[model samples]
Target: MNSEHTKTALVLGALSGLRTLSATAVLSHYLRYNSNLKIKNRRLKFLNSAGFALLSKLLATGEIAIDKSPNIPDRVRPGGLSGRTLSGALVGAAIYSINKRRIWKGALIGATSALAATFLSFYTRKQITRNTRIPDQVIGTVEDVIAVGGSVAVLEGDR
Candidate 1:
């Protein structure tokens, strides 16, 4: 718990798992400040290089829009879950890549947290929609707001 690597991994990983967009939000801060973190993935590096933080914001906006569409599948579904996990890990790694620490710690925690959150959030949504008679779309919109707030909160913690 005292380890910065573990602390960052658990906190960022869980938040990212809960909402993949949180990754983009947190990383955007790093990019803006020209932080010491280094992104190893080619695609991620390119995205970061190409748009600074705009790419992440665009992707996050798209995700929020898609979340309300019925045509979109559950995030817990195989493909969706995989995407969440990958994004979570990458962003987690990016968050901890500074100081030349063990980056894999962040990756593992992010992926694991994403997997767990995928199931938990999915089930919670279903239950809420079923029991409360609130439409999933409405609930999803609320979730979008939560994601944004949570992402900001996580990044604020770094200060």
Candidate 2:
């Protein structure tokens, strides 16, 4: 795949590591609004649908809200990490499919980046919260902003 596509996958994947549904939500929103871009894969056609866009947005919003709660599990946990990895893989594959490139390569890069970012972000957040004396909720909100803003920036950069 080209450098542009690779960059897209990596950025979106890292965003997924921060917030599992954020990348997919942004991607679905992009696909829904950008009628000029079409998904060549039939299976991924749902990503461009209004229903999927709405559902993804709702889920992402809920995830952001719940992320602040102390009851929520750490993202480094197996289930959370796997979910992030899958989200990255899906977003990466969708991007590659849209560009008519190799989906497997995109998936691999996305998954790997997401896995690494999960650990990196988790530890960094932990350290910041411990050393800076900032509330985790606040730090989490900042992370949410990074994920959402970063996703938007990456997709917009492509256009």
Error of 1 at 133 (Å): 2.5
Could you give candidate 2's per-residue lDDT for residues 1-159 as a string of tens digits?
489989999999999999999999999999989975667788788999999999999999999999999999999999999999999998988888889987888888889889999999999999999999899999999999999999999999987
For each candidate, what TM-score against the reference? Answer: 0.82, 0.97
**Model 1 TM-score (2 dp):** 0.82
lDDT of each: 0.69, 0.92
RMSD of 2: 0.8
lDDT value for model 2: 0.92
Q: Model 2, residue 32: displacement in angstroms?
A: 0.7
Worst 10 residues of 1 by lDDT: 41-50
lDDT of 1: 0.69
**Which candidate wins on lDDT?**
2
